[model samples]
Target: MRGMKSRLLTRREMDDLITKPDLPSLIADLENTPYREYIIGAKGRLDGILCIEAALRDNFTNTFRKVQDFVRQEEAERYIVIFLHRWDVQNIKTILRGKNIHVTSEEIASCLVPAGEMDEATLNELLKQPDVRAVVDLLATWKIPYARPLTRAYPEFLKTKDLAVLECALDRYYYDDALASVNSPGYNNQIIQDILRLEVDVINIKTVLRMVRDRVDPEEARRYLIGGGRVFDERKLGSMLCLSSIEDVVKTLANTPYRFLADLPESSIRSQKISIIEKELERFLIRKGVGAFRLEPLSVASVIGYFWAKYNEVTNIRVISRCKTADVSPDILKEELVYV
Candidate 1:
């Protein structure tokens, strides 16, 4: 894990990749990096942004798999498994969203990173289901735990045709299960718990911003809130829900560790560019995860740190690839990236 972390691109190397004129040049530059083998193999079967993205996803999945394989301590492996379950949640969300939009199964498959309990074969099977309902039914037939939440939420999803209904259900289940897994008392479990709570807070913050932007009623939005947040609890989140605008919602975070959300430019706040806020929040979590590296070098903190660092690297590469495809200026592209 330390070796993998050491291979992450430095700020200068990332800048160099960002300044590449086009996709091919970017691919050429990457050939000299750790990503060379995966990118080269992907380039043969895919083209343009898809090639770069596929390589990034494959590399990330393989790296995480190696970490899982390398860890031998039973307790440590359990924590790692809990951390990796998020990927299963994410892959399910991707498939559901793709099915909702009527996209081809291949497109959905391209977006998945099977780094969780659900292997590539399992995901492929889910992709073969005809539609959203079929996918849920298949999961239930297979007795996957996620099937419970999806099955319970399916009725409302059918009535409203709203994907958020199902997505929130998955989020609630995953967070609930993760927190429970780390409920036992230990320094390592505490580390994992803290990270999970921070994640819950991040998700809740994004949920608030979305509700405010869409003008959803406070009471209605309450149902979407996930529990176990370290900072904002039910009452605090409820208060945030009643806030009038994005700026007001952000201001509520002012005295907390997330005070930087309120520090963003007035223009960005006024324009309601939630993506900017979301990116900053994501960077905040990445920083927290990376900081854990030194907290307990031999414990779960190192694992958490390496996971986030790798995730951040892959995400930055993907952003650069997409921006290059669109001919976005280097200056503007830099803003879109989340550097910890």
Candidate 2:
């Protein structure tokens, strides 16, 4: 709202722009290898950033199609726009990481979303540049000022394997910015706030759990806890830590919205099996997001719903692909799958 001069699509406007005719046409266009073409469109337009359209066309063909029917997409587009923002940032995140660690340019290139910010030339150039600092510099030309945060934070992010710090910074910055104007006239979108709260909360909880398991000090663990997720607020997290066993953990969380995971009586939890809990909770979030999208189809709710689904699709495909590439057993891969 502060810096972006471009118009954001209103619910009514989104309804008009994305129609039945538009959906199938967009979907049809996505059939082949348009990823490169998307890269082409997104690259030089770094300032205006058409990556959102690219992402919607590339990754969200089904969602775009469903919405284009004009009956279902208004809600989908709410997030359809923002998800483009988020996933684009995420792609830049991974690419930056790969570049920092000196992962191959080709290898890094293969993982791009082509819909977010990076264009092929700039991304290629950034990848070819020496390190993370160069990547930050390459993105310096961006009109949306938030890219500066990553540029500034690279040193600390390098010192700590705390990629989440950068990610969390981006996350908090994004929602804080997106939700800042929610109370303004003609813009009463609370669903974005609510769902984002849950997501951040889940991430904070997972981070705290990982830190504890990784043997980071309690003080450090406390430091790592993000202050405000729907589930893991400071108070909730304090109570959660007092529980000794995973059963106690499950039961303590049983009363909260997250209690859904505990409803599965047979799902056992060993400390080492915490990833299982993480997976189940994540799937629960996706399912919940989908339901929310259906309920509030034309608002920010639908956008988030489609966003979550698209993310799951991309992540699932990546997981399956990586497993296939690694020649892992189906049994093991199944264990790692989120089943969303």
Candidate 3:
């Protein structure tokens, strides 16, 4: 783990790429790093954001495979599995959305990242489903575990025709299953627990904040709140949903470990720029994970930390590529990126 961590890009390397004058220069700079081979393969075939996304998917998936090789223990493998489960959830969500809109198989397949337990073949099969309900039914036929949540959420989907309800169910289910996997009696899964809880906390915070900004009913928003956050339990999250404003929400969090969220620019919130807060919260989680990585050295925390840092790099590169293609200003690009 130590040697592998050493090989990971330093903050300086990310800065060098970030400061590139244009998309071509950024792509060129990436060719000198671990992303080289992936970028090379994608060079002529794809351009702009598509090229960057392809390379990143390849890089991340390949790196995860390496982590699997590095960690031979069953417990460590389970941790990696749980970490990768998000990709499965995300892929399923993408397919559902595509099916809902009646997109063709090729279009749906293009949007998927086979970075989880689900392979390309399985995802392609999923693309064959006629609608979202059929997709859910397909999962059950395949005996995939995610089927349970999607199945349960299906009735609500039929009733309200709201994808958010179904998506929330899947999100909560993923967290519940993930926590259960790691929270075995007397296991040294504290770091895993902490990371997952922090994620839950962030998700809950974002949900509450969005509800406030969008004027969603407080009681209704409470259903989307996932349990098991280190802070912001059921009662607290409900309380937060009832808050009148982003400022009040931040103030409410002032006494919690997530007080840093209060530092989010209030002006942005006032101007309906809730995305800024969401972006900041994402960076905050990555930064916290990276800190744990450094503090814990060769432990699982470091591995998870490296995972986040690498993911952030991919995301930043993708942002730079797309922004450059769109001729977006450098200042705005910088604000969109997460540099720690």
Candidate 4:
């Protein structure tokens, strides 16, 4: 962890990258940073967003490699793998989406990030399947746990042709698996569990808000409600599902530990500009992770916090580069970013 901390980019470095005038400038700046080798490799082979994505993927691969290589504690390595599984879930979801749309294998391969358990070759093989169902079947054939939720969601996906059902099932399975993995009785593991629980809360809150906004039936909306949040158990989420409006949901949330959510503008939520709420939630999570890092410098919390910080930095740069390419004003892009 001590060695990993020094490798992480400082706030100033992130600021410098964020303020780059254009995508090419950003790529140029990356050449002088830890991503220099990836930048060099991507030169001429890729450009613009593709280049950035490739560099980020390579950077992610190296980040985990460095952590696992440096950390002597077997426990720390286990937690890191658990943390990285989210990307595995993401890669699978991307493949599923591509399969749903009948995209070519190359097109599907371009979107994958081999930052998790499944390597690039495995994901590419999954892409070669004839359809999304075959992809889901492949997971079962491989004895992967993700196949269960995906299989359960497949019939509904076929009936409704709504990918959200499948996506939600994936989310539920991922969080459930994450929470179970970290549920062992201990203080450091408890910290990781809390961070994950907060994540589950944010997902549940957003799901409920979107459902209310879309006028989804309460019973139908509850299907997306995930358990394991600190503030929201099955019963509490059920109660929330009974709320008539986003305003009511906000009021209900104000009585809970996540009262910070009340700070979000009800009008913005009603207007469907929920990005503000999402950003605030991310800021809240980042702040909590940082706090845990300070309180437990030698513990897994430090790695978790540094990971979130780096994750946010990467996300900010990606958003800035993409927005700059689209000629979005710097002020608007900065405003959308969470800087904890």
Which candidate achieves the best lDDT against the true structure?
Answer: 1
lDDT per residue, candidate 2, 191-212, as tens digits? 7666767777787667655654
* Candidate 3 segments whose C-alpha is farther than 4 A from its true place: 185-187
Candidate 1: global Cα-lDDT? Answer: 0.91
Full-model lDDT, candidate 2: 0.56
TM-score (C-alpha) between model 4 and the true structure: 0.93
Model 4 residue pairs with clashes: none
User: Per-residue lDDT tens digits of candidate 1, residues 21-100?
Assistant: 99999999999999999999999999888989889988988888888888866567877798679899999999999999
Clashing pairs in 1: none
Q: What TM-score against the true fold does each predicted structure earn?
A: 0.97, 0.67, 0.93, 0.93
Candidate 3, position 141, lDDT: 97
Q: Write down the worst ten-residue block by lDDT for model 3.
A: 293-302
Best by TM-score: 1
- After best superposition, candidate 2 residue 8: deviation in angstroms? 26
The alpha-carbon lDDT assigned to residue 23 of candidate 2 equals 32
Candidate 3 Cα RMSD after full superposition onto the native fold (Å):
2.0
lDDT of 3: 0.82
TM-score computed on alpha carbons, candidate 3: 0.93
Residue 278 lDDT in candidate 3? 82
